[model samples]
Structure formats: C-alpha cells, structure tokens
Target: MGFLLLAGAITAEVAATTAMKYSDGFSKIGPSLLTLLGYVLSFALLAQTLKTVSIGTAYAIWAGVGTAAVATIGVTFLGEGLTVTKAAGIALIIVGVVVLNLGGAH
Candidate 1:
C-alpha cells in the first residue's frame, strides 16, 4: 500500500507538471485546473505513504522513479521525441531504485 501510494503520488505529480506546460501562463482554464488538482492529489498521496514507509527511502525512490516516469509520460503522451540515451537513462533509474530498496531492506 505504501508503494502503491508512492506510485500514485508520482503519477499525479507528473500529470500536474505536464498540465502546467499546457496551462500557458495560467491562461487556459482546463489545464490550469488540472495542474492544481494533480498537485493537490500528489501531495495527499505522498503524505499517506509516509505513514508506513521510511522517509529517506520513500523520498529517494519517489524522486528517482517519478523523474523517469515523468520523462516517459512527456515522450509518449506529449509527443516529445524519445532518444536512445533517454531510454537508457530511464532504465538506469529503475535499476537504481531497485537497488536502493534492496539495500534498505538489509
């Protein structure tokens, strides 16, 4: 559940950041509203995860995974080009997150 909440938080935060790009200096209503809602939900989910997860581990994984996820989201849904280097970078991030979690358990 803690990991689930963390994933949700990361997803929401990515959505919020993407929406912010479309908000056009806050001139667009739909994107602006989405940005606000996404951020609010992201923080709420993150806070909930803190109830069970260690703060340092949670924060590190959250940041690492969230960054990769957001980059994927941008490339896939936002029509941003995906370069080979970027793909490798995302893979590395996933590996790092796994290693971090594994080390934390010991």
Candidate 2:
C-alpha cells in the first residue's frame, strides 16, 4: 500500500539522518555507508508511493512529518539542545502534517 511505502521511506530517512549524525564528519565508515544505503532505499520507496498518491499532498506529509521526527530524535537521542524557537517551529510542522492528513478526505 501507499501508506506502507511512505512509512518505510520516513523510517529510512530517520535512520539515515540519525546515522549521519553519528558519522563523525564521515569518519565512521559503517554509519556513513548505512546513511547512503538508507537514503537510497528511502527515495526508492517514496517514488513508488508517488505512483498513487498526489504529488503535493504526499510530499508535504513526507517532508513535514520527516522533519518533525528527525528533529525530535536529534533533541532526545543525539543530545542536541532545543531552544524555544526551535521547539515552536517543530510544533508548527507537526500541526501542518496533521492538517494535511485531515484534508485527505476532501
């Protein structure tokens, strides 16, 4: 299903981004390679989902949700500090993603 593919892409992207953070300026070979492979699979899955999903809606959900998730991981797992402004920004992105899903019925 399109949802499955999209979810896979999002998961892959999150994993890729997390590894990229641990890549240590690309000094770590395993994480670096994992990042590249994850991205490749992510894009491939995204392309498959585009066959059925509308481009604008799909892209907005994909990017908006992915951004929020990655930022959350950065703040929580990666020890990345979060300022008030950044938190508010990520909250807005989550709102946008919820709105996009709600509009699916229209």
Candidate 3:
C-alpha cells in the first residue's frame, strides 16, 4: 500500500517533469497547467506514503528515482545527450538510494 502511493508519487513527478520540458518556461498553457497539477498530486501522494515510510527513505527513493527517470526520458525522447558522465551519475543515484534504504532497515 505504501509502495503503491510511492509509485503514484514517482509517476506524477515524472509526468510533471516531462511536461515541463514542453512548457516553454511556463508560457505554454496546457503543459504549464499539467505541470502544476502533476506536482500537486505528486506531493500529495508522497505525503500519504510518509505516514508509513520514513521521511529519509521515502524521499531518497522519490528523488533518486525521479531524477533517473527524467534523465532517461531526456535522452530517449527529448534529444538530450546520454554521455558517460550522465550514465554514471544516474547509476550513483540509484546506488545511493539503495544504500539509504538498506541502512534504514536496521
């Protein structure tokens, strides 16, 4: 259940970030509104997950996963460069998140 909420939060954040790329600095109406709505829902769902999940754990997963997903989208669909540095950075973020979760288990 908590994982479900966290997943929703991740999805909403990813959607919001993707829409932001098309928002033209918030000058575009549709994408701008979608961005606003997506963030609202993301935070709301994240807050719900915090009821059962520790803030450090939840936030680590949320931010880490969101960053990775956005970077992947940028490379795959947004014509952004996928250099070795970018790949290494994403890998580090995933490793850090996993370490945080593992540490929290104790």
Q: Pick the candidate with the highest TM-score.
A: 3
- Could you tell me which 10 consecutive residues in candidate 1 have the lowest summed lDDT? 97-106
Q: Write the per-residue lDDT of candidate 2 for residues 13-104, one digit (tens) a residue.
A: 88998899889989999999999999999999999989988778778877888899999998998789999998999999999878878977
lDDT of 3 by residue, 1-106 (tens): 8878998999999999999989999999999999999999999999999998888788889999999999999999999998999999999999998888778641
| TM-scores vs. true structure, each candidate | 0.85, 0.92, 0.94
TM-score of candidate 1 relative to the true fold = 0.85
Of candidates 3 and 2, the better by TM-score: 3
Predictions ranked by lDDT, top down?
A: 3, 1, 2
* lDDT accuracy of residue 101 in candidate 1: 83
Q: Largest lDDT belongs to which candidate? A: 3
Clashes of each: 0, 0, 0
Q: What is the C-alpha lDDT profile of model 1 across 1-106, one tens digit per residue?
A: 9989998998898889889989999999999999999999999999999999988878878788878988988898889899999999999999988998888741
User: Which candidate do you rate higher for lDDT, 1 or 2?
Assistant: 1
